[model samples]
Target chain A: MTWNSWFSHGAPTAGFTGGPSIVSRNNAVCNIYVRGGDNALWQKAFFNGAWHPWGRHNDGAVLASEPALGSMGPNHEHIFVRGTDGAVWSKAWNGAGGWSGWFSHAAPVAGLTGGPAIVSRNNTVCNIYVRGGDNALWQRAFFNGSWHPWGRHNDGAVLASEPALGSMGANHEHVFVRGTDGAVWSKAWNGAGGWSGWFSHGAPAGGMIGGPTIVSRNSGVCNIYVRGTDNALWQKAYFDGSWHAWGRHDDGAVLASEPALGSMGPSHEHVFVRGTDSAVWSKAWSLVPTVILHLKVLTNPTSFTVDQMVASMRDVYASRGINVAVGSRETLDLPLLTDVDVSTCIMGTTTAEQNQLFANRNGVGANHVVAYFVRSTNPPGNGCAAHPAGRPGCVVSSTSSSWTLGHEIGHVLGLPHVSPSDRLMMGNGTWNITNPPPDLIDTERATMDTSPLTVNI
Target chain B: MPVTMRDVRAVLDPDEVDYSAGARLGPEAFDYLLALVRDTDPGLAAKAAYLAGVIRGERSEEVVAAAAASEDALVRVAAASAAALLAPASASRVLNDLVVDQDSGVQKLALRSVPADPSPELRSRVREVSAGAAEPGLRAMADNVLRGLH
Candidate 1:
């Protein structure tokens, strides 16, 4: 079917290439930045029904990748794009203000290509991840009001597609990309450590032809989806540690567009992609019970004591028909660790402790469970030095608190950094602790549902 | 052993397999093969419908007919498109019923399968649906089909 309504921006192009990043904040607002006729970073934002003009970057020589957007705070959002100079730069708009002038960040190891992906864990804290010239994943985070060194970069063989990120825990995140071998690979970081070494899930049954998209329902669990060589949609998921087989769909059309996902409910997530005919098609499934419970923890690190944070997360989840529970740790009986899936835990921090607690409560059969600790470095009123870990402890400052949680949780799930300086989850831009873009939920959920889950042979 | 439907599903990547191998099974073999669409498993049914799209012959018509009338929207959409590829005439008739199908998804597939070149009657019918269809997706598709005819 003709999808005129869905063609919200950009006329058809000859190449399969278009803007790789499309994000919707609260579903009411969306920004899609593309490589324009001039090869500059061109953007269009959706407000009301119409798409705004093709806003070009005036200062940068040329954008090397797609622009990533995330809220800097309650009323402000930031856009990060890579320049031809191989340095990452940013611009912000805090509702009261329009797009601010561009600001540059310390360039990661040179030659960055592809648009960055940004996700705000909280208002002040964010991380940007990108693939360097070496085709290795590199990251820079906004911690204590400054950008950190691009974390130890590692290669994933060939990097033809951009990366996608998702929150894994309060201080953990995951990055996913298509390896040179055409298989999906992942790496993650916990608050107490740097990125873990790269790990290959397995080759997708079908040849992957496009970059993957990721979203996390909770820490340590995520689903990934990509277009196959035949132009059909293919998926692989990380649940309880092992990668599942690739699942294919017969949706009656070849999939040519990047898939977007949103939450249908707390236990349900859906993915949407443009068919070859340009029609938007979607598929959804209910997550298993253990997966649902685990996702809640990652999405809401403060689900126990932080009423405001929980409320905000709940509002976003509820808008998508997701059921969420917010209360204190004392009031709720957290599920035993063993009963949960633990295959995708990142090394370091309280992950071992949390996993141990879970296992003690459950049993060996609960090895599939994945658990993450929501510690903060900066407690209220503590200066940077007093902040836990000599940085802001997990609970230290509310600044990067939520955003960091979102970023870390992304790792526990299955996403990877999309841009080196984009956002924490995708490693493209700065982190803002506002509600995540609504489509982020959809993208993650859809990827998870469609991703291959290992079946007992 | 006969090529069971399970064998087809077990194929790591069907996109890499040669559709001509199935074609060698002949029309009757294909028809018997298409009957597998009625399998209870949604994944299996989905796979069968996908494979049916590659079969060529009159018996393929019967397979498409059965799939078109399926209760499953996924199967119906798949069947509608598969039918359009091989039997445009019969496909059009099936697509008409689907054009008004309850699910916006089915209607979408039906609109897509409708022949690009339509008889005047079909053109008029598409126009009517284009103007009256409630769902935005279906209305747009109907309008598009009618627009292409001119």
Candidate 2:
């Protein structure tokens, strides 16, 4: 629940001038780089349980600010820095080979204020951005084994601070910068669509200080965190086709540095910033619970189709903050099996003699909840769907509501009947679609989120 | 000293026993473990049956087979998984019954445990379930087993 801290040799002896940049290679090793007190780049390596001593890599160039870091391939890393000459310098570190001495780009940057923002689309191409002398953005890229000449992204807005970079997919990458107006403006590059004009994602309520930091949860969702006008931390997310309103998360602590974002796990985002106390601080944001349910039709249904049921179920659970993924439906050979107790419906088969009829079946994942929808129940009240606690699947009647599916599956997912008996888990053969029961309690939410079959996020 | 029912009970308590010591347990442990397959605590009985397979041998196989046939769903599920570790031909019959178990847990474990080289009879059973089982969970599992078997 707490971030583990490691103090490498040559840690910032002076206050960190700009945000330190770190990137993981092959997700197995993380290389961290910072501007040491002497104002040059110093780096350390973390891999296979041991940290290599900090080593300086800058080639006698006086760095004006922090360096940007990105990965090119398995164990390959690239670092970009703004030099005292106002020129952008670059270096590469290969796990197999050694360091590529700092090389100056063909064109010296005009204004070159802060560290450049750099990102790579896997091992194919790397893009770097820096503010130019005119206060506009300049960009260059490395592709097909060569560096392209720097060009202007001059979208008519002047940048006042450093830039942050993030890649949402193979073909998409975005750059965020603090505008002269203290607002955050973004311009994106789509592999097929080229560059887009700069757009505003809103700025801090107070004003902006340093650059913004961006991280992608997946190919479609990206979040940006920045220091607000009031020195508080603010965040906005680009998800589900539109940008979300900015949300504040300063927790009343003023920040002294730009934020850095990364994912510790699927759906888990951590934003790191420097508090006014000079100590590093982190806040984590987690996505909602996502689960997949596999339905097996054991009998022909007369009322509703399988897709209709799945859609209804998704809508019902989505309202409760749960993301439901219904797997493909498979038609089984027999009707739902009934137990000697008419109240309980058997899931797979009632007799051992029935085992031989189902050996070659496949497609069920370990985390999948298997539900068998049978025709009519013996005495059909709300139908007889039953499931044991902590099981992977359950049995439900075809005539049951989507709420019934949620209830029975909730039981398989480890939620017991709600004690008040007025909720969705209430087992009185009745449900209120419009009012429904309250959302799953915290403990139940945790159980559902941690279930092995659920998606990691 | 020979392992006793006390030792078996101790091992079944997750808090008290070291499960990783399953291989180090001696032959005497099997008899006691077999008796615990029907222990009053279904969870304990399930753990006992599973350990029987982990300490696998002549006696472990017998316990696994017997536990597979037990009426207790927990025991049956454990037995189904344990039986899969034994000689497929000898344990195939027990696995056949478990694959279609009324309990989803038992059915899942049984379907998962069916051997890659199951006997022809077991293969036939798997095919039947793959195509006819009322629950897609088992059917999906059956389909996976059939893919591997063929």
Candidate 3:
């Protein structure tokens, strides 16, 4: 049967309790569990363009905790659901391995109140985090064929909500949970260093009333989105070394569900949430370069030549909500500027390389720019040859070659990747590169298509 | 001591009864209320019907059915839902007749009162009534009720 036909038959039943984590795997398979009328865990899976049976499993008792699904190994997957007894139980299926019998693990707490978030970074290791009886954040990891307790369970204020997990590395992961005080808090495990002490980032702008979702862009950066007390969507992000605002709030008609984050491209990520109306809504941002107009004078350069250009660009960007910084060489701060340039500079003799040279001369680097201008009428030969003054009207062309600078800078400021047409920085060569997309600067001057960056707590 | 019928009646103010608390009434307290439905009080039957509509489960079917068949239209509409959940088979006939009831509110409730898992015969009945019903609201409710069956 067609996918649409199959889905129509297995459409969700109203009043089926489901605060469970729904996950889609690499193979395009999605797994979710809803509480059936009998309170048994009812399972439904989407595979081969069809939904499987709404299997009702009694398993000797009712299930109050939400079920979590993650990869067990290559070509295999596992599902964990908490029994009414508050014990963690697991079920698994391997491609040619068939289904395994359910197995129970030690309970995280005697009275499991909320669902557990499970994530697997690799084939053999999986981690599950739960809110404990004392309202603390508790976790258990299945590694080397057995479940290992990380350390003394960390405490969250009161009524800890569901904890979401994001991987930092193969063996490292971070857990985010909402505290009783309505703020979001986090803990991390860095393999050799073990689990870190709990840290509170501060209350989300809207108080956390539901579970939070965490998605990592890379090892050091992650974002968390949660439903506020008013049922609006709120976010917190962790980037570089600091936590950003709990901004990017969206109020919907119904209670919002925990968000799901997916990577759309390098440095581009999208977050999806079930809105109050039960329709899926998403926001994304991709990095893009900010152009700095530095005039080059080969023979004799004018003072503030770079400063005037930076000031103009800053004004233009500020009016649009894009912030720009002027580079200074008085201190060793030049190294910071150099590091950005060296890392962002392209390594090739192609047109892209030439664009990188122009970009470097104009002050646009990986995440920022430092434009340089000379009026000697004698430009450096080869790659550094200056474009004629009246060619495109804008002399130093040191913006990003593929719009990578814009996209990266967009991310640095706080936007997640979005679709090309709606993106502020549609990378060059992939689409038209002559000018920025019309939607590049939203009314707020901030890129509207991308998810706003906030510290993930 | 068990909550007495007098205590239940005392808490239920005629003009402003709490439906949330009414939902927690036990079998004995419910029986006392059911007795009121049969009382000679002028609007007492309608009030009893409204209370019965929100108090779910199987035991309230008899009183709910009596209320659904009451001479008062509002009481009949409120009892239709309780009847549908408690005794779908018996409520089927009244609900079907109410599909074309002159009161739009009664017809609307009748439409929503269909069971989620109705018998095929009842489903066909709903489809036929909804497809041929004159009132747009009733027809829409009939269509929705049919969908719920599936």
Candidate 4:
């Protein structure tokens, strides 16, 4: 979805200093917080389709840096900022009772310079990432019921700018930053796999002028924007699982500082920036196919375990509002089908060739899809999403990409190997594709959402 | 008997096993790595299988044999590497099983592990894998095995 033209919200702000922080408690209520010209927090509310007038917040909160906000859940809001005293502080709002007293989270041993970056996938977990005084990344978390002590990432990266944080699920987190070399870099945590080694995302042609800002449309997508060396907004996105090349926003909204992103769950998102005039401006956009797909899996065990692959598919699909559950897991027991050449299936031989596979495979037609786990598939694939006519399921290799399950199921729903190698239906060797949270493109999502197996929630 | 997570942890740290190569880790370490051939954690079990192959000592061939029988493809992949390192006579039995493995990766490595002067049966098996392997890389590797025939 393309962003709408920038909307200048002069809002009686004679001169806003930093990038604005914005979030939606739900789809209908948007709260945007910023540092007013008086070096204090200012907020404007958007509800029922109109943005309200700006007003002083936190009883004229004295701010030393930009304010960052996260929507824990509908009606639950949390905001964080670096105080003038060099300590990061936090406050909360629960839609009705007004703001809670500001709480200091203390500071990293090396202290910090940029506004604290924050993200939350649910109400119980929130993370605050900041650029330490040493230029390393420091983080503290609010988990379960209390705040945890500050910690530092051991990635050995020296940041040239602040960090941008995003979460795909409750346990997954992705953070991006501009390194001292002026190139964009990222690190990820997949809940089970832990933190990945830092990888480069390339640099804006004009070079990076500010820290990146990111927002996820769902579990399968991440959109990141940074102020470029060219003095305009540049963006790179991981959509439906594939990474898109970096490009400019083209809205002509030149930034005086970095940008901030906010969203109301999937489909609804906004980008706010401090324009050259020091006035807060924002552009909002929405995506399509806000629907849920359901598929139940039946496993046929092999020596290789299916837990990690199954769990990953569940999490990735869950983010896109798809529900996947294992129905009945049993062994295939038949050696012929268990270790057979699947060339005809992957390439579509004929009905008879397809019959060779589905003849003994059971657990069909329960308003969900089925997957047969086999020891292996000949012609060298970890899994085959291919089936003939009425089979409507996939045969998976015992040790395959966790995405192989989803990629194969995507076939039954009318998706093909139609996108990048990082996509769910990547045509090449999927086992080698290390990119996580694979993309399910808009067209593919629309197709999958309309399948007979999907019941809109 | 199946190896539990605790049982494996008691022997040696999983991460540290990768560094055990040529370290002459004592018998306890081999015992732990041996039992791990049946560990429920397939990924870790595969690593144990790899460690057993690279650090072939004190009945390590038994570890390689058990790994070949594992339903997990990764363990079998490690088994191929282990078998490749063993003396030709000792590695033949398991090498034959992996040569026909359903996973192309296992088949490719197993085919490459086949002794320079393969038995008539092994030569025929290499021909079969070269013909049926789905991946081009594996197919090419299998062909290389046939090319090296004396």
Candidate 5:
């Protein structure tokens, strides 16, 4: 949840005129492509645990604006930019074929006024957003083994800057632009195969000064980072089925150009902005990974039942951006499993019967967590997060407090008990925590972020 | 050394009292909590009530029952749940009071606290709630519980 300080990553100064498009290929290698002062596309790669020296990959191709970068299935990367002739050109690279020579897709007759934004839905499909010569938004795609023709999708809004794109789902994209009205306007595919009208997300009071950069953390969640008129970094987050107000991230790093956002899956999202010093400065948010839990209910207590426990866990985990409630739930009529004997699961140990119950996950992912709801643990114990090694889960007492479920599961995700009752990992009985929403500190968040059970939101 | 009401309130003030960890306070703490539940601060009263529920004694059920009457919705809701853990002597009436509480959340946990085989009076109250409750969500919950009983 908190961002790291602004680190320049040894950003090149001269000829860095303005650029910094960042992408992670296969979530392993990060290639930061920027339009160099020499009007050519250059890159600095981070792989094998080190940053490589800056190198040009465009074969001295003259670019009219900054370059956009995207990846397809971890094997291929595509870079799109405006050529000297006002046409949009691309240079593709594949793991097998290395880098290919630049080729022109031929721009709209009106021509491209800014760089393109690229999103790859799958290995074969990619969509590009651009600011057209008419000052409206336009797009094209590469699917069915060929490039589609230039098409405009402004919904009657004129743009003052280039557009940023978010992937809502396969075959659906959301586009946001800094409209000439000094507001952020969005037009998205309705998911039912239709386009939505332009909707304004309201800008900062002084209005925005540059284009917006976006990174979709998942299907329903995306965040827009931009430089406001005050020269500060401002962001608008869309998640939980709605858009929140624009909040400023005042880290004291003044933005000099439009910001660009990229992420390595769920690890973190880095916002790269050309700072006042004309160097690419970046800050990143350590994103939380989802904890998928499968519950085995024993006797549903009068209070704090398994269903209520899961709902409470969802709200607790939301503080760190984990939608643990978004997973599937079904009723299986297995009588014996439905009514289990947790009698032997005492203290910090699980019984053989408990292990047998867990053994039949019924195709649940190994990385997913399973919670066994029982009537009670050993005397004086409401739950225990210990199971046989290699099987990660916990046993919960049906009478445990609302925070106990999350507390035990937090143990599964590498959290240790702390003294304060106002925390989720409180060693004391969760039943007595005064805090309604217990805290999960950053270090605990980092520990959970690295758990294999986590898939980034 | 005897546990004073101040000692009980001080321990309960900053964080919650988890006697379950180790009986730092005892059945003696229950009477002190009962006095503190009358504190003007409803938040402190709510905390006193929950700690009383945790340290159930002769007065624990009544402590939550009194908390169920606190003007604070949070206090009432917390009592609605804590009532399930204390004395079953007055459990039905306390739960029935909570099930029809003005707060839907209180009604929810109270409905949830209904035993697998409920007393006829509790079952009858559930039937009334299922037919007509202010919150549709609460009504649906009662309806579902009624169906499962069948």
Candidate 6:
């Protein structure tokens, strides 16, 4: 069976409860931890290119709720589980060695209502937040290989469930919880200054029963997801220095528990939940509503103008969920530029070498797509998404039609060629530039949306 | 999560993948290979099976056996090929079963996997298929395996 069936058949969630937690070290490695029917902490890891069988981590200790996971070192992973004894127990795993036996973090004034929210920074410090017996928020941290004593951050608002945590930058962190009044309330920690007063996010989630799941897309933006009173998934993001109004994903499923979210890359977030059908359902969001491509023309053949090339691609890609615009343009002086030179410079080069060249010649900022186009009559396959350009960037043909331009850019945006002929990434390397016909497929859209450089047009 | 087509495509390049690297990766790599053989993507499953054969140790052969019985012909062919490359004699039973597969492509690959002087069962099966198989390619492959038996 193809993995496509796994999406419909779902991950093996035969007897899972509470919210699932997912974390990743990179796009290629991720782990999902959940409470098993036996009330033990079970996790499935995605390593290399496939999901490993689910393994129990708590050494048969029955957990009272779900498990929260974080990494304290590049090779070290920690899973904090609330044991049936009401004390939070922890287990450590090293990439070099396997798992260490569960250790206790002592109780935090009282037992936890559910699992705590866990996050790690620079593999040096880890913070855990849980709801205390007093229905107030409590916190603890791990630093210098030791567990810090529990501290209270009582935000006056009565808490009913777990508190979610997200870090905006090196030292800035945000903790969000559902107040007794059903409003989403948050307080932040500025590593240099300490905790701040509870700020009401003002989103009424009146019937939210569990903690919210939060993830930062980058240092500048973060998103929060919660199950509304209507049992629908709702989201709100903090972007451009302010919080946006809450919006519904209209996910079209009744969630059985609080959602779990993690970013696969910048501008790409995936939300997971246990559906009423007892299956895991995941939805992906690509926050990049548009993208700017910086074109550095080594030389354009007299046959076609760069503007014509841009207009052709813009006309084709605009309808397929990406707005293409030029953020900057420049031309370079060379003694003699030839098609063979362009091909040799790109195809024969390594990504590091290409990146070095771009770094020396272009001042394009991070999160900006940059490409070097040449007036080549014989570019690699008429165009190429040469990885050496480095920054979600590439090298392409200046003479190719808008279709080829769009196809190469698609590669820049993390798309791969598909077998079908009707799509933009047709296997035969042909595309319909005139009609373009929504050539971008669903997988391509999802991949593009998750691009770290994807942004509003 | 199931492996995606994109994931399968990522490792298709022979130059990009180090076939022996998985064996050196310890348990985590072994777990990955185990899951990959059962992947829904037949191409990925086939490739992983081939890699498992190259990495030959512990549960690698077990993974190849499971993949050899997969419903997808491509996966079964890959498993057969891997089995031939690794423990050909141990793969004799699987090759015997595949030598008569309904899919001619599977039959050809399975016949090609027969070890020198393979089990009588595999040799007899290959003989039968070579005599009656409709596809010339399968017939040729079966005859080739029969030559080795002789």
Q: TM-score for chain A of every candidate model?
A: 0.51, 0.62, 0.57, 0.62, 0.65, 0.64
Going through the candidates in order, their DockQ values are 0.01, 0.02, 0.00, 0.01, 0.04, 0.01
Estimated TM-score for each candidate:
0.41, 0.49, 0.45, 0.48, 0.52, 0.50
* TM-score between candidate 5 and the true structure: 0.52
TM-score of chain B of 2: 0.89
Query: How good is the docking of model 4, by CAPRI class?
Result: incorrect
Candidate 1 vs 5: which has more lDDT? 5
> Residue A220 in candidate 5 has what lDDT?
72
Candidate 6 per-residue lDDT over residues A337-375, each given as its tens digit: 212122222332544335443553467777887766643
Better of 4 and 5 by lDDT: 5
Tens digit of lDDT per residue, candidate 2, span A389-446?
A: 3336654544455566677676666566554444556533334334554356667777
Question: Proportion of native contacts found in each model?
Answer: 0.00, 0.00, 0.00, 0.00, 0.00, 0.00
TM-score of chain B in each prediction: 0.76, 0.89, 0.75, 0.77, 0.82, 0.80
Q: How would you encode candidate 4's per-residue C-alpha lDDT over A130-204 as one tens digit per residue?
A: 999998999998887888999998779898888888888878898898887788889998778989999888877
lDDT (Cα, tens digit) per residue for candidate 2, span B72-140: 664676687667667777568778788767776567667777877887877888888899987876788
Off by over 4 Å in 5: A287-457, B1-150
lDDT per residue as tens, model 1, A50-140: 5576566565546565566666454677778777767888878777667688888756665566666666565667878777766766678
Ten residues in sequence with the least summed lDDT for candidate 4 chain A: A289-298
* Cα-based lDDT for every prediction: 0.51, 0.65, 0.52, 0.71, 0.72, 0.67
How many clashes would you count in candidate 4?
9
